[model samples]
Target: MISKKYLIVIVGPTAIGKTSKAIEVAQNYNCEILSCDSRQFYKEMSIGTAVPSKEELSAVKHHFIHNKSIGDKYTVGDFERDAIQKLDLLYATSDFAVMVGGSGLYVEAVLFGMDEFPEIDPSIRVEIQNNYQNLGITYLQENLQKLDADQFEVIEKGNPQRLMRALEVCLQTGKPYSSFLTKNTKKRNFIPIIIGLEADRSLIYERINRRVDIMIEDGLLAEVKSLQNFKEINALQTVGYKELFAFLTDEYSWDFAVETIKRNTRRYAKRQLTWFKKNEYTKWFNYNESSKTIFDYIDSKKTETEI
Candidate 1:
């Protein structure tokens, strides 16, 4: 008989200390951490994306960070496939591996597996992309809402990729994207213990604001300026870059872009909580709590096992 493999997932909103705590747990379990963050994938984006520093990386082995380039195209579907493959190899070495990130969908994509979504037509996507560039996100968002209200409500109307995805589904399947989201969770061979960190809403906002300030101080503007040519890339449309892009284009005063980053990050964290709170599998802990307290809570729920 074969023994089952178990994975520990440390999940939380950004700037909540998931990486440091996850490193501690992984070291204790004698294994590496599997990062689910999408932004941290690009090697060019270190300071802005908060890719682990050399000192931090030297402390514990981490997988999937700085593994891809923003210039290279990758999708959530690709992430799901690649992560499963990586986890298989890691599981062969250790029964328990820590997977940590704030990317809710990417994290869920690996643990439960996504539904079989329909493929989109290339022309339809190109058309939508062209319209987004010409008409703006608000215009595209209006169209998506008219096509699929359910998915539109869930998506960040400002996000081009999400709007494009919803429109792609509607155009290809002639059905609403949300209708297909009935999420027949494809079963996986491993069991995951999910740990979520939270804090007072005000405190979380403060941390996010502080992080944005720190990034600016750490040369995030220079990093974004280097990628100025790639501003239209889907990955560059993310929170940090979008804010800086406004500054680069002279649409915002420097102070305004910095302020928007903090504002948007707070809203992003709120949406993250909304997404994860629905999952009953997650056990929440305060972000500022002692490590011993967190481990005690997690240990009570976890069973000791040997690979």
Candidate 2:
């Protein structure tokens, strides 16, 4: 008989030390790490996305970091499929695998699976795309807000692709996009031990500001400059890159752009905290908590579940 496999998921807001904690756990279990952070998947986005350091990567066998290009059309669905396959291969050699990221949607996709929406009409998508091209993101945002305010509250408002998809679903089915999100979750093979690291809101913001400053000092502007021609790509439409792109185009002053990146990163961290807190099963810890405490909690949970 096949032995049961366990997936240890480390989740938290940005700059919260989830990566280091995940590495510690992976080392303890002697297993590989699977990255679920969507932004860190691109090879071109290193400093701004806060991809793990070379030392961290060398400490553990990691999969999915810097595996794709910014130009690739990858989605949460694609990650879910690829992550599960990687987990299956890991479980064949070891029973425990560590998955880490701040991307709540990607984590939930791997844990509970994605919500299924009906096939959209081609014309609906085309119309939304055309309207987005001509009228800009505000048009899509306004439409989604009118159709599904709940989804509007949760989605990345600046991401035209997400806005367009939500608007397409709302228009195609004549119902709120969020209504289709209620389908029963798909089952998975391994049991997940979800862990969350949190800190005071003020500390979280401070860390985000410091991290952004470090990114700028570490040549984030040069990285953004290298990808300036691809600034319009969906992958580059993120907090750090977008703000710096505006600066490069004379749309924002240098100080203003840097401040905007810090402010936006803080907001993103708040959203991440809100998303992770909704999962009651997650055992929350202080950002500075020791790895041994976390390991003890995991072992206790494992014992209880196996009984």
Candidate 3:
């Protein structure tokens, strides 16, 4: 049975104002926040990660933001372990805690312990990375299409990381990566109230474009430049930094790079939505709705159930 103690999770695709809304909830319940944003782990990536605003940080205690160096090799497994530990401490001090982000894998890492895949040889990873560098991400996409046509329909072709991982497993075991998704969900003790914030597709795209512009005004370019020395860092392999890195490396004009950031951000948000929509447990809310309006729906659900 789920614990009666509350663990609120505010989630959605990127730019859905989850951080701000989480702060509001924390203030209301006098609880702390455990961030699940995979990117915000890096101390050096404030603007690019769209981390909590200063005011929001000041409003409530937040754990796991800006706590790791860019070079640190962290994984969802690590996050799951650390978050559970933090939750234990937080639960000791308060009856509730808010966890929030758009990271589907990271969120699942906490709520459901990630299934451990057999460790692939390091050479397998190196081989796949080399192939991606030589033949491009399209090569991996084509491979996935051939291996698992159904998965190819939903997978993003632009993300080399996912493509390479799938390709690596195929090359190593001659099996589709999707086939290895065989683990059952691990039970959790805490009560998770998942709240997803969403908007119309066009509205989400507009918000992403506007957010990219605001990120520019907030010094994303300078932030990227300062981290140029660490361009090869895995943390810097993200969308914003990679786009801006192209400009810094003279591969693209700054204008084109900025446009690419907006375009890629929109695609990322779409992928996030697709990933989150898979879970039947989430209750989605429109960003246009007032907090009271959304909370009323949640309250009604709670009253209808024993929760």
Name the top TM-score candidate.
2
Model 2, runs deviating above 4 Å: none
Better of 1 and 2 by TM-score: 2
Candidate 1 ranges with C-alpha deviation above 4 Å: 146-150, 304-307
lDDT of 1 by residue, 1-307 (tens): 5766768899888898888989888877788888898889988888878887788788898888989988899887799899888889988888778899988778878887777788778998898889888988877788888989856655655578878888888888988887776377877768788899999998899899999999999999999999999988877878888889899999999999999888888888877777778779898999877878767765666554332
Q: What order do you get sorting by TM-score, best first?
A: 2, 1, 3
* Cα RMSD for candidates in order: 2.3, 1.4, 2.3
lDDT of 1 at 180: 74
Candidate 3's TM-score? 0.91
State the weakest 10-residue window (summed lDDT) of model 3.
298-307
Candidate 2 residue-wise lDDT, 100-208, digit = tens: 9998889998998888778998998899999999999889999899999977877777778888888999998999987776356888889999999999999989999
Models 1 onward score TM values of 0.92, 0.96, 0.91
Model 3, 1-307: lDDT tens per residue?
6435667888887887898888877887789999999889999999999998888899898999999999888987899999998998888868788899988878878887877666788998998788889988778898888987755655556667767777777777877776665256777767778889999999888888899999999999999999999987767878889999899889999899999998988888887888788779898888766878766765565555564
**Model 3, total clashes:** 0
Error of 3 at 156 (Å): 6.0
**What 10-residue stretch in candidate 1 is worst by lDDT?**
298-307
